[model samples]
Target: MKHWRGAVALTISSALVTGPAVQVRANPTAVPAVAVCVASVGCVVTVVAIAGVTYWVLSNNGQELRIPVLSYTPTPDQQLEDWEDYVWADNEQQARRKCNLLAEQYTNQGGSLVTVVRVRRASQRGSRWACTFRG
Candidate 1:
């Protein structure tokens, strides 16, 4: 049985090694020029899209943003006077730090009880009143 198996394996291996040469032929149908052009354009567009997305991600990451800080103090006549200022910083923490410094400076300049009323993005400053006296 072992001899028979060895013989069969040898025969199969030899047959495989001496098999007829298989010829591979290119497709007889020619690819349309328009299809080729379209494929090229698609690849270019994909590359461009990937590059654009990468650029947007890197450029916006840790980018300094314009933050609007609204500080207010009470006037002598008991009216709340508001002041809008822009803080350019990378994040909210930095903006808050800068705002605190500004508050200290404002207080030192004889402003009474400077309070940060609002800290928001500059984009949300639509139709917002600035330096106004609010009661």
Candidate 2:
């Protein structure tokens, strides 16, 4: 009788453990309504934030840049009158140095034009002088 009782208890416990753990049900219509309300609120907040940012940006706009007035006339300091005139100095180092100096001289003499103009010789003789400007 004791062995029969133990076997019955084991069978009951095994049945309980193997039973369905989750209760499945049909989808509710109210869930969609709640999601729509939350989504609408989110959209409204997003629009208000965008409008506020745009207003702030427009209200605090920066000053416009004015054209620089040059105090001194622009002039080339170094002159090369040979085949090397057509070739640019080996790297950018020389060109940058010249540009900085030219820009300084221009700003010093009330010259509003703070620009550097590079003049290069053409491949052929009497060709129009090739020029480039940097600011």
Candidate 3:
């Protein structure tokens, strides 16, 4: 039984070694790299290209932006409470920092002391924080 199995194994090995070359069809066009890239890398590349093109279009047209700061100074005796337009910063922390600076400046200029009532981010390339001041 062992001898028969060994003989069968030997015959199979010899046949495979001596067989005609077997060609693998990775893709219809036979470009292996293209096929692999399309399957894996191409999707990411396509997404990035689309994003770049979108950014370019918006940047060239100056459309990717928020109108920014509806009214610079709140009316006398009225602290600007309506948010969404005043704050322009990348994050809340930065917005707070900027708001504090503006408050200090507003006070230093002989104006009544002001406080940061609200902070909002502008819609443009996306880093402006509009800080609303209140006394």
Candidate 1: give the clashing pairs.
none
Error of 1 at 37 (Å): 65
Alpha carbon lDDT of each predicted model: 0.34, 0.29, 0.40
Best first by lDDT, ranked = 3, 1, 2
* Number of colliding residue pairs in model 2: 11
Better model by lDDT: candidate 1 vs candidate 2: 1
Top lDDT hit? 3
Candidate 1: tens digits of C-alpha lDDT, residues 86-133? 666656666666666666667667656565655655655343222211
Task: List, residue by residue over 12-118, the lDDT tens digit for candidate 3.
Answer: 12222234322221121123332233344222111111211211011112223211112234455655443223545667898889788878877788466666777
What ranges in model 2 sit over 4 Å off? 1-88, 116-131
Determine which window of 10 residues in candidate 3 has minimal summed lDDT.
1-10
Question: Residue 113, candidate 2: how far off, in angstroms?
Answer: 5.3
Given candidate 2, what's the lDDT at residue 14? Answer: 20
TM-scores for candidates 1 onward, in order = 0.33, 0.21, 0.34
Q: Provide the clashing-pair count of each candidate structure.
A: 0, 11, 13
